[model samples]
Target: MQLGAEDTKAIITRMKRAHGHLGSVIRMLEEGAECEDALTQLAAVNKAISRSGYALVATGLQHCMAEGGPDSVDAKKLEKLFLSLA
Candidate 1:
């Protein structure tokens, strides 16, 4: 399913934020930050990316269900796509 306009915008915003967060994690490592501190920031970045993936799947599922009848939606395909993120 094509991304709904709002979903696309939200996803882009999330990705951009994640990009900035990831840069911070990298910088922290380069600056000789404590291992624990750098790892914490890295975990935040990972969580952000995972959340974005979930948002994408959830939005696509909604779009597919709304645009096509229930019978037209492929549950298996969507499930695989969602699980791939895991």
Candidate 2:
């Protein structure tokens, strides 16, 4: 299912934040930051990415359920996608 403009914007915003966090983590590593500090930044980046993934999956599930009900193939596909992240 196609995403509405708002959902697409929200997803893109999440991905952009994740991208920025990843860049910061890379910079921290390159700058010889403390291991603990670097690890903390890395964890933040990981969480941001995970949140983005969850948002995408949630949007897909929402659309699938609305359009085809919970038992539809699209819903199953979205479920698999979400589980793969785990």
Candidate 3:
């Protein structure tokens, strides 16, 4: 989980993009935009954030597994980690 500057920057970039999308949803709501349109945008933002989070988790797991070697594949821990994310 100890990401270097470049890796951290990549995560930050994804977060910023998600934030921007969230802001757009807020702006649309504040402007009294169509409900369906706003909901659609909200869904898109949610999907983006979920995808980004999963990607980060997968990257972290991959790095941990690599460092920890073959025995790192603990089913219980993996299930816990995934459930906690959910």
Candidate 4:
């Protein structure tokens, strides 16, 4: 899907932040952090990544649907695309 340059940059920023969070979780683990604390970080990182991916899928689907026209081929293609994301 084609995204505006600014929108693409924003998405990239979100992904980079998520990547950083995962790295932090790894560093914390290496330092032998508490199990509960590590687990919480793990959950947060997972949620962040998942949310980012979902946002991309939603935006792409919206764009596709808009371009494809109501109940058109593009919409069906977008439905499949969204399902794959799920």
Which should have the higher TM-score, number 1 or number 4? 1
Residues 1-86, candidate 3, lDDT per residue (tens digit)? 47567656777788789899999999999999999999999999888878777777777777778889768767787778787768
The pairs that clash in candidate 4 are none
What TM-score does candidate 2 get on C-alpha atoms? 0.83
Off by over 4 Å in 1: none
- lDDT per residue as tens, model 4, 1-86: 68676656767788899899899989999999998999999999888877787788777666656877656446566678667656
Q: Candidate 2 on 15-76: residue-level lDDT in tens?
A: 89889888988998899999899899888888888988898888877777788886774646
RMSD of each: 1.1, 1.8, 1.8, 2.3
Candidate 1 — worst ten consecutive residues by lDDT sum?
Answer: 1-10
TM-score, predicted candidate 1 vs. hidden true structure: 0.92
Task: Give the per-residue Cα lDDT of candidate 2 at 30.
Answer: 92
TM-score of predicted structure 3: 0.83
Give Cα-based local distance difference scores for all models: 0.87, 0.83, 0.81, 0.77
Residue 23, model 1, lDDT: 95
By TM-score, the better pick of 3 and 4 is 3
Q: Candidate 2 — what's its lDDT? A: 0.83
Could you arrange the candidates by lDDT from highest to lowest?
1, 2, 3, 4
1 versus 2: better lDDT goes to? 1
In candidate 2, which residue pairs get closer than 3 Å at backbone N, Cα or C atoms, i.e. clash?
none
Candidates' TM-scores?
0.92, 0.83, 0.83, 0.76
